[model samples]
Target: MDDEVTTPDGLRLAVVQRGDRSGPTVVAVHGYPDDRHVWDGVADVLAGSGHHVVTYDVRGHGRSDSPPGRAGYDLELLAADLRAVCDAVSPDRPVHLLAHDWGGCQAWHAVTGDALAGRVASLTSISGPCLDHVGLFLRRRSPRDLPAVLRQALHSWYTLAFRLPVLPELLWRSGTLPGALVRRERVPRPSTRDGLRGLELYRRNMARGLGRPEPRHTGVPVQVLVPLRDAYVTPALAVSATTFADDVAVRYLPGGHWVVRQRPELVARCVAEHVAAAEGDPGTEAPALRRARARGAALAAEGGRAGPASRWSGALAVVTGAGSGIGRATAQELADRGARVVVVDLDPAGAAETAGAIARRHGRHRAVAEILDVADDAAVAALATRVATEHGVPDLVVNNAGIAVAGPFADTGADEWRRIVDVNLWGVVHGCRHFGELMRSHGEGGHLVNVASAAAYLPSRVLPAYSTTKAAVLMLSECLRAELADDGIGVTALCPGFVNTPITTHARFAGADDAEQETRRRAAAAAYTRRGYSPERVARRLLRAVEKNLPLAPVTAEAHAGLLASRLSPTLTRALARVEPR
Candidate 1:
């Protein structure tokens, strides 16, 4: 339905409502240079989910009546308009607020002040920070924060341009501004009138709000969606809302400034999750939302013993082969960062030892042990379901379980080849398949790290079976990375060389007698010991790879050199593969 909401200032704002009238109300407010139509895509999705979605144009935009002068565009007046609309729409119930850009600024003002006290249930702000919060953030900046401040200042350059007398208005009127937005942000063509009148928002509020900002606080739950690629707002500035709000969650999304238009389904999913979290039973809050709580508040609630805050705090991670070597080290590293880790290994003693060590350092709740053979698809799928039901979906998954095989290709029988491929290749495949789907269904992004080897790319004669399996894993990781990009999941292939680990002791050597196999194993182990590389180093690189979302991470000096050589000269690599070890 379409109607006119008359604000106390005598301006008539155009309002549109959709979805079931009996459902909980969600009021969506659009940013500058956009009208109620900016929320069309989001509203449709929310409406389908049974939310009474409402969208409206603020004063001086769309069908709304323009104020007589710039003085009428004060922040207080904008807050009052929000109050008048909420009172007219649903006076009995507290409505959830979803806002973008300038609309978020107004919503922040309303919720922070008494204008909408007890009237707003929750607030979801996208690409917009409260002017007062931004002011306080700048006022409290230190030397270490100079880079962040500078980045934000560069983003706000257009805010300064808007302060100019008539240049901004001319740009909008000439279609230059709208054209730029379409080309740069991929947003639909915006109306010139909305662009022209919205300038008052900057002129009337920017200086006063940021220069002498008030101590604004809100008791309402707030979710700040920080778009990593936002052109107008830096993620640091966008997340500053955590400073003032009592209950706040900051979620980092992958998109530009106009993410609402670019990824409406994603925006809607996040908004709905926040709204449900606000309205549902507190005990049943989503794990992602719980982890996203402001660092200070979460730490204080936990009795201030969670150690220093980290990006991985409260995250859940699953690592296979966590009994020894790189897998155990990675599990411990994640736990040190405040993540709850699930340590899975075929050996019960190894898994228990890893988990026990983590528990000793970070409390008993920090880690759990599970026995699993990764080659079994059914078992892995069952584990994925159980983990989701009992511990929530994992935010990070590391598939590091594998066996090694050595000796000539001709001597490697079908059974030996099958055994190595089952553990090395199929194990990674099962982890990615089950857990990747769970992450996609949850609508929140996660990371996957698959452990390959330098043998994946470097030609090898003595390690033909091992090289083939590792190569297949590397190719699988690359393909999955491309396929899962749109779903927000990251896939990384970790290739390490000559790490001092127990794999050498267990490797099977084809065509060799039992005694000869044992001798070769001792020789290989001694050579690796001489190289002096540690699994802990590979663990650190794995974390960095996930953090940066790197497609392929080559650890150890030899791994890097081998990768370069294989890519630069195929003939030389092949010739080197023919040399027999002494």
Candidate 2:
């Protein structure tokens, strides 16, 4: 349906509505130099999903009636126009807002001021920052934030050009401006009239709004989509909404300013998810939204930073082999950093112990224990499904389950080799295959950490079976990293040297009698203890590896040294493999 919405200032705005009228209303507003057509792609998706999606041109754009002068483009009047449209479309209920660029700016003004008070349920702002928020961000600048501010200034060089007297208008009239936009932003050819009149937005509002920004706050749940590749707005500025809104979630997308046109389905999906979450729908709480709430509460208490309390705050993590050693320590470490951890292990008692410790330290909901043998592909797949259904998709998965088999290649039988490979190598494969699929399907990026060993790169005759399995895991991580890069999933292989853990005591020794096996276990365990590297240290490195998205992380001095030696002199490493340690 097409209609004319009259603003309080007596201007007729061009409006179009789609989908069933009885459904929840979603008012999508377009940016500068673009008409309601910019939202055609997004509207089609939202309307098909059973939303009453509305798109409209502002006062002086498209088929809308233009006011006499620049004063008509004031933010206050634009906000009033938005309010009038919302009242005309859905008077009885609060409507969700989808806005981009200048439209986002006006929507922010409406939600913050009394223009649309109690009328907006939520707002999704794309590639736009509230000028007041930007002003305050600049006013409260610290030395550390200067680099980000400078980067934003560089991105916003065109705003200065827009403020020029006649150049922008001349360019718009000459076909050069539309050509530049279509070539650079990959947007459809914009109407020249809309392009010419929208320049008033920059000239009329920019200086006044930014020079003296008011304190703007809103109770509406706001989702800011910060396009990392946007030429007009930097992520730092786009996320400044967190400082103003009571409920704000910032999602960093891998696209440019016109992402709505480029990836309409993805943008529409995000919008629907945010709207559903605002409507209190079950299972609609994404990890980013949860983190935003947690951060908002924390900021309310401390009046501190605007971002997450910790990088892992409100993140969901799955750590396998959490019965003890590196896995247990990693679960605890992630819990300490504010991540909810699912502690998985083959031993039920160990998993419970780790969960209990985490619950006592953080809270009861921070940990869940599951018993699963990672080598079993079906079991791993089942666990992945349960975790996603119950706790949402995990942001991090650590494949740390493994068994050690130290023996000469000649003495190691097929059964022994199979056992070690299944536990050490296939365990990682199972975790990655199942959880990685979940992450990809969820459309949210995550990280996978596969724990290999220094034995992966260090050739050792006594540890031939163990070395082969670890080497396979290392190569698998590298290959998976390359494969999943486009899907926004990161893969890491953690190689640690002799950490003081229980693996040595449980390792199988081929061709050894029971007494001799016991003696070898005792000797290996003691040697590892003497080396004195702790699993906690390895756990810390694991966190760093995830944060940095490192492809290969070598933990402990000997691990680093072994990796360096393997690269520098394969001859020397092979020669050392011939000697048996006493």
Candidate 3:
């Protein structure tokens, strides 16, 4: 349904409503030079999920009527316009507010000031901050925050240009402004009036609030979706906003100012999660919402520096083959450090056990289990989709599934080689291909840890199949790291030597009789047990490698020595490969 709502100042605003009116109402607001249609993708998504979605054009943009003078576009009047729409849409109930750019600026004023007080249940701000907060942030900036402040100032050059007298109006009227927006934002060419009338937003409201900023605060839960690549608003502004909000959650994404157009599904998912959490229904809360609640307040309040540990405090991680050995240990290590973990394994019972242990240690929702054979491309794709749909895009992905096969190349059968290669090499391939796509699609950078092995460079003739697969994995990691570097995604190859694990007991000894195979398995397991290295130690090293973004890491002392020897003394390594194990 489309209707016209007149604000207190006599400006008529265009409003569109969708979904059942009986459901929770959500009001979405757009920024300058854009209309309610900017939220078309997000609105349909939320509406499909049973929420009553509302999007309105700001005064002086889209179908809304522009007021006569600069005084009409003041933040106070703009806030009143927001209130008017909220009142018309949900007269008896509070509405969840989602806004971008200028709309977010006005929404911040309304939510923080006395205008909408209890009328706004929650706010999900995208690429915008309150002008007063920005003012206070600049004033309070120390040497540590100077660079970020300056960077933000540089990004705000357009704002200063907009304040210039007739130049901005001329650019808009000549279609130059609209062309730029079309090129950059991929949005439909906006009306010239959108640009010309919106100039007052910068002229009247920008500099006025910087001089005598009020101590504005909001009790409403706030989720800030920061586009890290936004040309106008720095992510630092989102972090700074924590000071004024009682409860705040900050998520960093990878997009420019117009992410709503570039990645609309991601925007919708984030907004839905925030609204669901604010509604006080835990059952309806998404993983992102749960993580946000767990993250608590921003780090700025405590005066602590932010890093992977702090950033991933409440983030989600997905680990494959997390049933036993290094996989299980890595899953436990991550969960203990405050990340919600998804434990995936081929064995259903093993996966459930890992999940149960994590849940018992952390909260019940901190860990979940999924059964999968990582070699299955379709299955891996489905898992990736399900995780993104249910848990949001994972912040870290560990492709740790593998199998062990031991024997000389001449004795190993084709079937044995295929079995080992399928699980060891193809498993990692499936995980990376599917989950990596999800990370890229979400427009948020993530980490991928592929578990290779020390045999990758050790040059073992007896362990032909095993070493070949591990070597391929190592090479794959290097290639992926180079490819994804520009996108902020990090890929690492984790190589661990002999460590006490169940892999030895389950390893296949090609060309051996049944009795001899069992004997070899037992002997291999005993060798690993005597080595005294543990899977937990390897797991810890894996975490560090990811945190540091190491391209290639060799865990055990032997692994490190082998890597050095492979590079510095290849002749010696090749000579050693000819020596057969007893």
Candidate 4:
């Protein structure tokens, strides 16, 4: 059940209760520009499973009171609201606190503040960091007051262009963008659009205050979650907060800005591990970290994989978004090398074709394709249950359903924008949340394959949101890589450069369906189509990256070149990039 509590400062806060009141209570503080609903994934896991979870809108965001203007938007005020929520919700209990983004900053403040200091048994900070170094997030904040509002009106051409007077009017009234963003991140997706008004609040006040500083002064056991590719909070920034405390433990997972929505189970497991530790249960062991590097070294020593390799030969493998491209290639590759493949896709016909082809070549039953949409939460959960029951717990799971998006940030319609994010990015998240839990419980270590892009590493002006989502995917994958490493689950990030796929057709263009754009993409992909390797080439690279336990995998010579340019000679890459007319 859920209800709203007014903060002492007169802000309305939403608090959700799960299980009995006596259970461990976790106050989850979500970051800037987002509401309490940000914690829905983590909240559900805790509540439905018996722990007590409380979530609330933070000042300007979500369903909470926005007040009249910027007068209420400041660091101290934001931190104060968090304390008020805790006081109102679980004043007596030794609460477990989980925070992400801005909430992480507030949690840092709470741990340091005189009020609730030492009251928290354990804390988890996700994709946020110490306040001082949060220049990355700060650089993007909106200025205070009317000037700030005007700044959004001016510099935020992307947001303005997305809906404009017409589309924006419709989206705001219909609440499509906010609702879709929320629904995309939630497991089986959340129902209410309560605090969703905060997206505009965030856009208007892009200038959210700095996050909590490092907890060096606090002695509470801590868990810090960092997404290596986060656009707002860099991993370095997240790591800086750890230096403040001695009891720091870290878990990194895959996905971006809103990872909890996509991979709730992964977040749930890690959060549960921390809470269980605070409650004094035997801790989730960390074996993979100590030995993953050595294992990768051993595989390299043995020369490439001979079949399924020792790590996953007998393991059940579930590959989703497998109708074509890397998904299709990976599924068939696994079957050819002898791992049973469960080919999953939203397109049943495409999936069946892939499955039938696999059958004819491998002699009947080597692979099976099931039609499904991962964005649909119930569908994902059902798939997880069915796979566990039919194929047994899959030792390997791949989140690969992705579509291509191309266009200037402006003209892409809301539905176009929402669908790309839901499928390409969030789909993997849903799979990880549901399937990851199933694999973890089976007691057999499993591997997760998330298909992020080379785009994950950099922000592209042309494909603003698409690039933004990939960056999130990269970070989310990296976070999972770190956390699951100890669990003997090797996480591989398939970060590919441009490959020939149908992603081109779906590319959201600015003007008409101009022939020029198609011609350009064709010419660019022609480079690959010429000496081009099949998607199987990428699949092979992916398998090798997994066996080698590489933290990141780039798929093309162009990708390797870009890495050298981005890392070794930034100016050269910039100059070369500008060599072509924009």
lDDT of each: 0.88, 0.87, 0.87, 0.65
User: What TM-score would each prediction reach against the true structure?
Assistant: 0.91, 0.91, 0.80, 0.46
Compare candidates 2 and 3 on lDDT and give the better one. Answer: 2
Cand. 2 Cα-lDDT: 0.87
Measured by TM-score, how close is model 2 to the native structure?
A: 0.91
Tens-digit lDDT string for candidate 4 (409-496): 6767788778888887788788888987875664335688888887776545566667777777888888987877645566777787
Q: In lDDT terms, how accurate is model 1?
A: 0.88
What candidate 4 gets wrong by more than 4 Å, as runs, is 1-312, 514-528, 570-582
Which 10-residue window in model 3 sums to the lowest lDDT?
298-307
Instruction: Please report the TM-score between candidate 4 and the true structure.
Output: 0.46
Question: Candidate 2 — which pairs collide?
Answer: none
Candidate 4, residue 205: lDDT: 31
Top-TM-score candidate index = 1
Q: Pull out the clashing pairs in model 1.
A: none
Compose the digit string of candidate 2's lDDT tens values, residues 304-336: 233335357678899999999999999999999
1 versus 4: better lDDT goes to:
1
lDDT of 1 by residue, 1-582 (tens): 999899997889999989997888999988898998989999999999999999999998888899999988898998899898888889899999999999999999999999998999999999877898788766655665667778888888999899999899889988899999899888889988888888999999999999998878898998888777788888767765675778887776767888898778988988888899899997788777777773435543533212235457788999999999999999998888778999999999999999999999999989999999999999999999999988888889999999989999999999999889999999999999999999887756789999999999988889999999999999999999999887678999999999999999988999999999999999989998999999988888898888888999999999999999999998889999999888
